[model samples]
Target: MAIVDEELPTTIFDFLPCFFQVIGIMVLVSWLNPWAFIPSGIATMCMLYIRYRFAHCSRDLKRLEGITRSPFYSYLTSTIHGLKVIRSCHAENICASEFFSHVDTNTRVEYLFLTTTRWAVIRFDWVTVFFVAIVTLLSIGLRVFGRQFSSADIALTLSYSLSLMGLLQWTIRQSVEIETKMTSVERILEYCSLGQETSVQRLPKYEPSINWPSHGRIVFDNVSISYFQDSPLVLRGISLNIEPG
Candidate 1:
């Protein structure tokens, strides 16, 4: 899903273009007033720093949202399939409560994720404000020092400097989003790499006879089971016996 929905189109249509715009505009702004690079460079560094911090938080939030969302959908699906049985058992209220509980939990996580995004955007806006202010001051200082920048050059520099705010924010956001979405691909690859159970094979020369187990008894001892190797055991240390009746 991430591969199709995000990685290809977002990278092509969004991140790359914004990234190039940032670079090209910065270069052109510097050509107007070489001193302009200082504030732009500072703002770029600050944006990267903010992005690093925000990415870690947003990545975890996205993962949590995914985790919380699955149970909601899973429960909703199971409830749909079991509606008749639930009604017959007079468990509608209980089922509804459970469903709403899942909804509440999912909503909470989603809200937290959104609020964090808003917080990052506000901080990005602040950084952009400071960047523009410094650029304006630099322009004034250059003029006072008889560096004589044309009105057109000053306007272009200021305009591009203002535009950089949104472009930088979008680039950082998209890049982090791409990284977070890649986690889905990571999970898929991990699932693909898991060990599979081998199929039983019977050869003509080494086949077991139908009545080989004449005792009609089976036994198990100290068995442990888990769905995945890295996951905790669901069943541990069980012993059982089945004897011929």
Candidate 2:
């Protein structure tokens, strides 16, 4: 999770440049005509709304994807390690079916994440189109009634207006992508913040001295065991007494 969050191309370091470019373009548009702020401001609000709606959904999906991915990797690794035993036991079909099930589950989650992403991009593009249309119309009005601005100035503004669509979409996409990707870091931190294991309290009477056992014997009383604190117990209430041969 840490590797995917920090070392991946989707990190904030890669998103910052696009964010700055969006700001630069907005500034340039407003400089072209102060009235452009009316449309730009409206577009900004719409973009913010879109970002707000998508962020929650995207973050959840990303976290789910991260979780669903783990079992697949774990199963794959274990299967590879146990290939010899599995083959000798003639359990290849069962193992193969289980592997595919994990793959299918992981793939379904990934597809949903990608689909939600596309949905956000499409909405963002629509917002950008609206902004560009407003800018173009405002530019035409300024040229027709208010300004003695050069043809070149109008052309440049229109050109920037057209390019703004891509910049705006890219900026929003990166902003949300980076935010969603940070869920990986959040998951890692979650594991870090888990409660520590409780210390065992051994009674002095029951505690054995060093080299105390003369007979080779072992006893377990209502012993429950699990691989991890949160995992289900593999051995529950096991009582066993063994004597050496």
Q: Taking the tens digit of each residue's C-alpha lDDT, what string does model 1 give over 1-245?
A: 65646564766578888889888988888898888899888998998998889999888887788789889999999999998999999999999999999999999989998998898889999999999999998888777686688778788889988997778889998998877676667667777999998776557986868988778788778889887769999999989998878
Q: Model 1 segments beyond 4 Å from truth?
A: 2-8, 197-245
- Would you give me the overall lDDT of model 1? 0.85
- State the RMSD for candidate 2: 4.3
Q: By summed lDDT, which 10 consecutive residues of candidate 2 come out lowest?
A: 1-10
Q: lDDT of each model, Cα atoms only?
A: 0.85, 0.83
How high a TM-score does candidate 2 get?
Answer: 0.81
> Which candidate comes out best when scored by TM-score?
2
Residue-level lDDT of model 2, residues 90-196, one tens digit each, is 99999999999999998998999899988888898888888888877888888889875667877887787777667777777777887877777788789999999
What lDDT, from 0 to 1, does candidate 2 have?
0.83
